[model samples]
Target: MSSSALDVQIKSLPNQPGVYQYFDSEEKILYVGKAKNIKKRVSSYFTKQHDYGKTKVLVKKIASIKHIVVNTETDALLLENNLIKKYQPRYNVLLKDDKSYPWICIKKERFPRVFSTRRVFKDGSEYFGPYTSMKTVKTLLELIKGLYQLRTCNYHLSEQKINSRKYKVCLEYHLGNCKGACEGLETEASYHKNIESIRDILKGNFKSSLQQFKTQMKNFAESMQFEDAQRIKEKIEVLENYQAKSTVVNPKISNVDVFSIVSDESYGYINFLQLAYGSIIRSHTLEIKKKLDETEEELLTLGVTEIRQRFNSQSKEVYLPIPLDLGENLKITIPKLGDKKHILDLSKRNAMYYRMDRLKQIKITDPDRHANRIMAQMKADLRLTEEPRHIECFDNSNIQGTNPVAACVVFKNGKPSKRDYRHFNIKTVEGPDDFASMEEVVYRRYKRLLDEEQNLPQLIIIDGGKGQLSSALKSLEVLNLRGKIAIIGIAKRLEELFYPDDPIPLYLDKKSETLKIIQQLRNEAHRFGIEHHRNRRSKGALQTELENIPGIGEQTIVELMKQFKSVKRISKATKTELTEVIGNSRAQKIINYYNKE
Candidate 1:
């Protein structure tokens, strides 16, 4: 929090655009910000008589600061947003709800039925939503039903026909809304034709499809088909009205993931706008923890890298918040004027609004206490030359010599670096030997690190005691990586820690903030390792059983796996269900063979 410390930190920063963070002594982030010029933006905080009412009060508690320089202002904006979501800082505006949004689920039946749901399970179907507004999804569904004259009744058509009295037309039929299928006035071909029209509308081709419907209505009117023309006219009006209400943000660009970051002193918000074929698809908001004295550019860079690492795809062309320095090398663009500007402006406004809402919800006055304590403890206990900027942990998992897997999780300044998480399928190790698996994983991981000439972890924590520690040390020695990395082993005895080499494992007092943080990191690595192991084991078992079936080649097995996800599910499926997924002959063979017992 000293001016001298601030000056020292500023000397190391680049003059480029980026996002920055202010961290307390315990390494808890206090504020996040974005900057056009890292040096100027960060230095402004230390100047005397600056507009430092709230920031001045918060800055007094600051222990340290970190930054990430990006190629452009827009990239800084994105990075800032991503960081806010990752570390919900106390001073920034944040969105509270983390619930999954509702989506429209279409059951994979012979005749697919659409329904609105917030929950998505491993069921055989397709989901298309997470729509920002439920009203939009409902209106579209209603419009499709009106135009297509598809079945809206929940009762099964065949059951209704078989169990009920001789078929009688419903009210929709009388109103010309049913297509007269109940009265047998229309053939299956005519009904299916209407269904196809509905499908087109749902796919967002409303303009062209509506025009065709209008032409048909006119032709019917010219032919003196009064009732038919009236029906078609009504459907066309419905489509036009629906289109009129829907706001079009951009018509030129399709399938874009728009991002905007809003931050103040303590926290930030990253708003992700998903557009599909020039239409708004959905929006997601994430919160970030703020750093005290870091520049905006550094924060934004970190945010973008994290977002890109977590969510970017080859199919996406990222839009920028400001002009980038990467120039023509990257596909980032800052809109100067016109519709693109309008879109970016809208995104910025949304982010700002979210920030305001978040600021209002913050109740804490001084949020750096916990972070400072943890950092202090870590420094004292680890006997480090400097504070640990990046800590890496390793854990291995397997079940009785089957499907062994290892995971390496990275923590940069006391938080998980999801982008740096690595998983290894135990290849060099043959059995359930956790020690050997740990050794192989450790060797391969560090060997790659050496080959890539990357930074080494400040502290490496293994999940087991003496044996595991010995194995890791042996691997490091064999790979000529022994002296380059700092390593430790953490063994858990019920609720206690047993450290290797040290006769007494270091255990912080239960009330200590540092203990909680270290425990979180260790547990996360363990959870990650176990999850990876289970996934590999499950996939291996399924693939082995599936490959044994005759005529069920790898491709077919893959298809079946993609559809059903598990061998147990596939085994439980009926011939009819299997046929629907993989055709009749294969389904019959699978059903007969699997059920033969």
Candidate 2:
């Protein structure tokens, strides 16, 4: 941490227990630590001997340090936990798990059946695993179903109508594997006994069960029971076939993870894989360049440590992309030939492709090239006196004639400055009048800029024709901002560009790069504006419904609506909970009215 920043911050700190945070220039928290003596513990980082390795790197980037004094060490510890959970600092140990893993579930029914599922919800079923791969889980379920002759039908055994003609035996009965309990062809006791045997097999007693079946087959053959012997022989064959097909790539390399990093000058990607019984159980591609500030080697080291901390380990064999002297039992190699090389090559290719595909999906083009072309063209077309550096766009959205709203989005050097984006909930305009709504939004947005003495944008783009352009210009004039800013309106059809005084809009050639750049900006503004409007309108509609409730007038309704944001949420609140918002008597009345309804 910067000594000056730490010194300035520590001056205000009380000589009490608390948690402190060190932040880098990018506003990212570099480290979070708690101490009994808040000032002394935080100041230790500024001392000369403490500056080395990760700490040295952290200290160099430190722009500011902050401290929060607490009542006691326990309070500091609790606050530290909450901060760690919230910020998830890069240096901290984080647990990791694949969010979309599949599981095998057996429903709680009279004749319980096993099935593969990806989703887990609040249903009374016995669930096993978070299997790494859906295909692997599905294959296992198929093998179990084939061997046990379990019912694959959706109908629960208890829900199935007893003594009904619809309960006919399926194909499994024809193979003599199924005890035909479906049609009352076999006693319930015998069917349940078979199900219990299946449950044992599912619990991974395949070897013991197979041996027992083989022994039974031999005894039947010796007693000249050909039919029974044949049945047992078939069961043994199924088990043997499964064992043969389930080949382990490396028996020694069970339950491990492998990670690799690939990067160019500007960006890097981390490729990770989880293995079980030497098979790739799960794979992940993480885009790490956006979060990293270190070199390739530092990123590799940090990535390995971070991932290891994040995930559980069953084995010591963690494969790496490059060799490091961590003194662990990890096998670090850069394979040049053979199966290991092939797998490594596959991982590298996957990482590269993943990075490329992500970049393409996001339409991440060179900002400098596009920005330069657009700025040049805009100055020439709009007859501006100077090049536009900061551009602001306005757009309005609503449904039919309800909850009209507008959005103001800012772009600094062709990238959105999200922190500066503003939204206006059409207060002055009541209905779906786009021109009037646009005027209100523009007026409110620039009024703040003037009031705050903030820098005005060199260019303003509105998503409409001449009417919208005139409204925007009028708003600027009312605020005495005209001539201080250059403005144009973009229309969707024919890709027309209109000015406030122009009677006819100008259409740029479709092939022009400048036109494409402007179109991208205009579309982005529209998308952002529409999204905010929809959210505000939805919330407003919900709030209006809260106001309609008995004993809930506008003011109480506003507080309740602002507190909970929805009718469904308000419905779940009790009288005491409602009292926390308004008061005891009013809360009771509101609760009673809702209860009665």
Candidate 3:
């Protein structure tokens, strides 16, 4: 952070606890943090050099500071968390998910049906969870089915319906799968009791279900029903196995929400774990894209709100890796060590895995959005006024001076726009003069766009050093577009960026997205131009071969070429066909010349 900017912000900084945000010159939030003493903590950033490369880059980008004052340190923490969640600054961690997690819902019909779903309806029904994975929901459902004979059918089992005998027992009843509640073979009281037991099991409370199964097994064995006793014992084992997968943390740390964050250069992932009686009832990770520079706290805060909102979280307390303000009523804990810390670490690990998964998903599902992010990063890196959404790059291909040509390759949104690509044959330039050829092609390209009033590119890239860039500038000057469009040149040797009048070149990081896109443009333009140049040279050679013939006039050659496309095709032509194309006088001469050869 610059001292000039800090000097002013620190003077107004409150001695009390609060959240602070850093912003660049464009006023985009870079990072969000909480401090007991806003002045002291923020001052520490400018006073010393940071060891981390990311931190140093962040400090240099900081143009201004903003803070929100609060009463206690806890309040500051809460506010910081809220802000981080809200803005999701680039330096802060971010978690984002557009869809809600799958939940196990017990429909509120007569003889409620249990199933897994991702939607949350307001109709009166019991919803077990917004589980992190559908696999978990499927496993729990299988366990419940094994433990108790629940109806899978969606039939109305009201007393009037059952008495009317309107519904018949399906295959499930005959297969010993259901209790035949539709025929009233099993009473509503018994069905409700089983459902209640399943509810407890979904909440990670397996005690009641286990005890009931054990009692049933003991009674069956005592009554000499060995087969029923064995079946009941199997059900007990299944329920226990399901419970064992969960119940990893200390059970006493009940009803606590744990959140942790992991981030990359362009994105952040935050994982949320909902614990009920020391078992993870629900766990999920959210993916977020960083707009500027966000911190871990900011990302976690945002993830918490999104996860809570999507899954309909009502937990009042949340455990996080760092202290921050989420709200006045919500309790926030930052564990120093022990079980809580272990759980927090586990949350961070989930976030890390989620980040990797999302990166792969993005490359496949939404490549356009990924390209936009890369373009936005380039815009910021280049200090360009606008994103280079539509870029046009020019390369001159005057190889060996045989047939001078140039190519203009267009990129609409960080990908090649082949239809808009153009090749020039250097109409106004002579010899191996690249500067003159560049001036002519650039003028022709834009002059037509001006006459037609067509769209212009946000940026123009010249595929050489300052010499080529300056020559292109002259045409822009003639067209009165010197300042209207942003232009730069890339030197091939060192990949240096050159501005119009600036002597010093800006060297972007070799791994930066901006540099990558520029290299793509340069390579594409060179490729496009070289292809056009080769075609022109081959075509010229074919025409020039006929020019070597004696007494072959220009008009006669034109007539022959119009009839025959290639030299090979013309040589294959009969005397009659040649006479028809160029008439008897030239055709006989041409045939005689070829016959002599």
Q: Top TM-score: which candidate number?
A: 3
Clash counts for the predictions, in order:
48, 2, 23
Q: Lowest-scoring 10 consecutive residues by lDDT in candidate 2? A: 306-315
Question: Candidate 2, residues 1-597: lDDT per residue as tens digits?
Answer: 456655777676767888888788778898776677887776666665642256667767777878888876646655765676578787543423344667777777666667777777667986655655577777777666665656655554443564655677778778765666666676666656656655545443355667778888999999999998997788788877765554234523445667778764335677776655445655666555323234666556545544554433344666666775433455666667765555566677778888667645554566564455456556655567777778888888886777787778888866678898877788988668988888888898989888999999988999888888988888999999888888989888778888767778887768554576678777877788788878877667765666666677778877887888777788889887888999998888777767888
lDDT of 1: 0.69
- Better TM-score candidate (1, 3): 3
| lDDT tens digits, residue span 1-597, model 3 | 566756887787878788888899888989888777888888888888775557888888888998888887656654665676678677765544445678899999777888898888999998877777888889888888887788998777789999999999999999998989998899988988998998888877888899999999999999999999999998888877777778878877877888888765477777889987678988877777765466677666666766776677777888988786666778888888998999899998888777667756876899976776777677877778888888999999989987999999999888899999999888877799988989999999999999999999999999989889999999999999999999999999999999988999999989666898899999999999999999998778866777777778667777777888777787777889988888777777767766777
RMSD of 1: 25.5
RMSD of each: 25.5, 22.4, 9.8
The C-alpha lDDT values of all candidates are 0.69, 0.69, 0.83
Candidate achieving the largest lDDT: 3
TM per model?
A: 0.41, 0.39, 0.57
Q: Could you give the candidate ranking by TM-score, starting with the highest?
A: 3, 1, 2
